[model samples]
Target: MEEKKSNGLAIASLVLGILSIVIFIFLSFIGLSWIGLILGIVGIVLSVMAKKKNPTGMATAGLVLSIIGTVLCAMALIACIACVGALGQTAETTRDILTTIY
Candidate 1:
């Protein structure tokens, strides 16, 4: 009887996908979205590799989760950058106003 070998890549992909989602949820606001985004990208690559190596439900799930995480992280990162830019403009405007008033 031949035994099926475990897919380590699939397992890693799943774990990384899950971690990416969790990190994005907890730290996205603090500009940690890049970390989650990187993790999600890596998970996506691993999942694709795993799928190519051995088709499995785990790999599919990992791909889905990684995609979701990557999207969320990207959105969060954009929002943070927008917010920073807005604040900077506001500060500069305030400084100008104060200088004119003085």
Candidate 2:
């Protein structure tokens, strides 16, 4: 009989990947994408380590999901920054216009 070993790292990676995506989707608007980005990065690391230890389907899935989540979080963060910049520019313009009118 052959014995099987459980891969806890792979499982943890998969769970973290899923959580990262979910968190990004649900809370990204309020500047919470950083949390997702961090989780995704950790998941990627764990998945890589798990793959080295036992190359399994779960590890591969975790890697893919983590990459996707990380990308999404990065995009969200960039968009948020751009929006804030635009808003600041607009506010300055509005203030200048009001001052000139006054």
Candidate 3:
């Protein structure tokens, strides 16, 4: 009798990929770009594993979503870093004011 392996990895990949996309969207709206970047990396790993294990349509979908999430996250991170750099170049008094606000 042939044995059937559980599709657990594929399912997990799908779920994580979807969650990554959702997180990316939410982060974009709230300006929490770092979280999105982390999630996107996780999603890409899961999706790639899923594809290697199962090669199903769902896995392909997950892969695509993960790639999109990664790109968006990267862009967000770059924008955030640029903003921080610009802020750093501002007056020393502005830094003191921000430190106090935080």
Model 3 segments more than 4 A misplaced: 1-6, 80-102
Steric clash count of candidate 3: 0
Candidate 1 stretches greater than 4 Å from native: 1-6, 79-102
TM-score of 3: 0.62
Tell me, by lDDT, which candidate is best.
2
lDDT per residue for candidate 2 within 1-102, as digits (tens), equals 111232788888898899889989999988899999999999999889888878899989998999889889988886432244544567677677668755
lDDT of candidates 1 onward, in order: 0.81, 0.83, 0.66
TM-score of each: 0.70, 0.70, 0.62
Q: Write the per-residue lDDT of candidate 1 for residues 43-66, one digit (tens) a residue.
A: 999889888878899889988998
Worst 10 residues of 3 by lDDT: 1-10
- Sort order, TM-score high to low: 2, 1, 3
Q: Sort the candidates on lDDT, descending order.
A: 2, 1, 3
lDDT of 3: 0.66
- Residue-level error in angstroms, candidate 3, position 29: 3.5
Error of 1 at 3 (Å): 9.7
